[model samples]
Target chain A: MKAAKIVFGLLAVTFLMAPLVTILPLAFTSSDLLSYPIRSFSLRWFEELMISDAWRMSIVNSLVIGAGATLLATVLGTLVSLGLRRSFAFSGILKSALLLPMVVPAVILGVGMQITFIQLGLVNTHVGVIIAHTVVALPFVIVSVSGSLAGIDMRVERAAMSLGANPLRVFGHVTLPLMLPGVLSGAVLAFATSLDEVVLTLFVAGPNQRTLARQMFSSIRENISPAIAAAAFVIIVGTVVVAGLVLLFRAAAQRQKPSTVTV
Target chain B: MTASMATSRASGRGSTTGRDGSMAASSARVAAMNGASAPFIALEQVEMMFGTHRVVDQLDLTITRGEFVSLLGPSGSGKTTILMLLAGFLQPTAGSICLGGKRIDHLPPHRRDMGVVFQNYALFPHMSVADNVAFPLRMRRVGREEIEQRVTRALDMVQLQHLRDRRPAMLSGGQQQRIALARALVFEPSVVLMDEPLGALDKQLREQMQLDIRDLHRRLGLTIVFVTHDQGEALTMSDRIAVFNRGRIEQIGSPTEIYDRPASRFVAEFIGETNLMAGKVTTTGPDGSLIRLDSGEDMAASAADWPAAGNEALLSVRPENVTVQPVGTARRTERVNIMQAKVADSVYQGDHLRLHLDCGQRRMIARLDRQVADYAVGTQVDVVFQADNCRVIPT
Candidate 1:
């Protein structure tokens, strides 16, 4: 039974990693075109990617836009989660509306944002793309932060207040520190969301603001060069590095967690 | 509100005739009121409403400085609500609260300078014990050196100074309780409110903590409002106990007064074990009264605050007070109130043997000495009740 379970798990993992496994080896091909057959293994496509200004500029834009979107989404989502902690008549509706972004179709959101940004004179700009990415990333931040917030005993806040810490101080000292794990994970999720965003960037971003994903999209449509495969490899490696660092930090934090004191 | 307020207060009055009765209770209360320079905390007609559902209704109480008073009640009886109201977590919809002769209901919890030890301790998990105790001091912007000194002193009070560097999650239940107590007391707020602070511990530990808290209360001269549903804990630690029912305080008196002469049926049933028999008042005097039970048995009981002679009454007697004498040839003549009963069952309980007896159509139980041989079922026995132990409560 255990062997069967292990076999099924391996099958699931293989299914998930199949795309990455197929795309990763093309970057090592000697031929200019991305195909199965390779004349020889070479670093020519990587060199091409490094020398091209468009690819380098796209990487920088992606980083800048991702950071900006993450900052905006994390702040807004955290504030919303905190506000939602206190119950009110319309809180249910408000929470549902805020979380609606997570379920909305990306193409619909992209088209809606495009039309809205055009009238607001924010079209073809970094700010437009960042805002679009933030709209999508905000739901992840809210869900993660609210989960952490819900885990905290509300009485702890009251205890803080009774112990002479005002509301602001209570948040600064107790609530924020307790919710750090959630906030960190949420910020990382927002960053990843912004980095991987392409459909919204295509609708709103200009030539000057083309992100790495947008450049990759254009490269796929224009040509089947192995440089695109090289870019894919870099993107995959970069994502793995970021996620690995986050998981390592989380594990360290979990190790420091004290044993249960039932009292 | 005024009418209910009068009833709540009157329930504690006019019952000065128990073994440890009214005179001492009134004196203790009077001493508490005049003992301090002023009543440290006063709640006047405090009404708390959650939406339309009233949680606390026109509750009026005054706690003198340095007094240890307990609010005792079952769950949802509004005792904890009063503590939260005093701590400024819940706002009273209609009344005023004053601390140190100044109105404080308008102030937020932090500004009110009241400390609370939560039922679960609520100690900050991320902080070391010293930091947890220093949190209040830090918020008040106390000097770093002073905070260090006071933290040491607070931990020392709870005998937890050696565990100062340990995190709360690493401590035992008792140690965590002490840390929570230390944190609450470090700031030395005007009043300390503890909500079932010892409820989580085992029985033995709870008893030890009860004594420890009472000792600290005396030594530190702290004005404490303790909330607990455990009647024994309240009786052990409190100078006075306010018994609450529904959303109002049913009675408030010293522990002995509450136990010996409970004001109402609720207090009698809630405080201790009592065998209550429905009766009608037949004769009343200054010292005692005579009641005829619904079972047609006549019983002599201590005088209670009854409306009239023929009105309904409840005769409550503790099991320990009911002596069971085996039916014999001559020894039963000296007993004043005696009735023939058949032993339904008898169980040995280490220190005492409980005799469950049936007298006519009524079933009663008596807690007898362990030295007495157990009476077998269906054996005839004589159950005696002294007038001092039998209390007649007016309905």
Candidate 2:
């Protein structure tokens, strides 16, 4: 039974990652435009990617928006989650309302947001784009933070309070530390969402504030070049790198947890 | 969680009233007594309501300086609710709680100056033992060096210092509980509350932890209010045990008193196995009274305040105190209280024999030491108990 499970596990990994495996090698193709079973491989595409001003700007744009969205989503989501917890009067209703951004089709939210932004004259600015991304990011933060909140034995906070610390101190100390990993993880996810956000960005983003996905889309419309493939490859790599960094940070953070982890 | 121990450590403040040596002594006394104060913790006529139904009724209790009190009850008893009230997690709809003479009922739990331990230990799974112990101290803002020193001391007290660097997931249940104990104590809070901290352990481990917890209390002299549904655990470790029922404290006393002289029928039956035989007072005697059983037998019993003549009462008899004799034993003398019985069944448990017998219309069990040998099931026998040993409780 164990051997069978191992076989199935490897098969599943291959099934999910095999497409990326194919795409990665195609990125090195000398002839460009993603032809399978590359006839030749060279470093020209990598060099082309390095020299492309458009690609560099896209990288910078994605990072900035990812960071901004991460910061906004994490803070808003964590606060809302904490408020929602132990305040059930409107939390249930409010939580469902907040989650509508996540479940609603991205195009619909984008359309509504576009109209709202046009009225407010925010359609062509970086800040407008960030707010839209942050809205999508917020639910991830709330869901992550609140998931951990439910795991916390409420008794611990009470225990702290009875010990002498006041309410804010409890939040700053006991409650906050325990829930941070979930919060941090959520922010990373929000950053990932914003970084890859193409559907919403297509409508809400200003031409001057073009994101990586938007840049890639425009480049694809114009023509397929080896640099575009290189850029696409770089994007895929960037996503992986960001995810890896989040994992590393989380592992380090957990190593220093105050609760007993080892036997 | 405390950033420093001082932040979460609620002061009794009574020492401030005294000067010089008296002040030191006052602080020392409170520390010695269990960091308790003049009515530091109060459970005022507290009631817990679930819609219109009251699960816990009005309860009034005051825990003084340095007392090790255990709330003992069976499942569904309101003992846990009272502990929650003291912990500031549950608000009483009708009453308020005062801690250190300040109203704390409306205060959130973080401001209550208490340390709590749950049955599952509630240790953070990602943290090492030392970090877990240091958590509350950290929240209270104790200096880093002091936090380390106290964490070390607390860990050593529980004899888990060697495992301090290990995370909670790696420890055994007993070790986790010990780490929890250290964490609760490292902050030096005024009171520590434990809710069935040892309930998850096996019997042997449970008993061992009971001793360790009691010893820890002695060494630290920290005031604690522990809740457990186990009667043996309560009697084995508590300085005083409060018997709770439905939602009220039925009785409170030392182990001996609670065991030997229970205050009510609920307490007597709840604490241990007892043979409750209905009896009625027939006449008053010098020391107590002459009672007649519902079985139409006259029995003499000594107790304070004889019930009115023919008033119904219950006789609480422990199985260990009940003796059984062969049908022809001459030990059944004239002065002895003997009744004819048949041994309906006998269970042989190492070192003892449990004999179930039927005497007249009442069922009685006698726990006889192994030396007495075994009585075959269905054999006729004579049952006996000393008059003073039977607690005749008025119904």
The best candidate by DockQ is 1
- What's the TM-score of each model vs. the native? 0.92, 0.84
Error of 1 at B14 (Å): 36
| Model 2 spans with C-alpha error above 4 angstroms | A1-23, A32-40, A50-53, A246-263, B1-43, B96-112, B124-127, B135-149, B186-189, B219-221, B284-286, B328-336
DockQ of each: 0.43, 0.31
**Model 1, global lDDT:** 0.84
Question: Clash number for every model?
Answer: 1, 38
Task: Please list the residue runs of candidate 1 whose C-alpha ends up more than 4 Å from where it truly belongs after superposition.
Answer: A248-263, B1-37, B328-335
Lowest summed lDDT over 10 consecutive residues: which window, candidate 1 chain A?
A254-263
TM-score of chain A of each: 0.93, 0.87
* Residue-level lDDT for B179 in candidate 1: 94
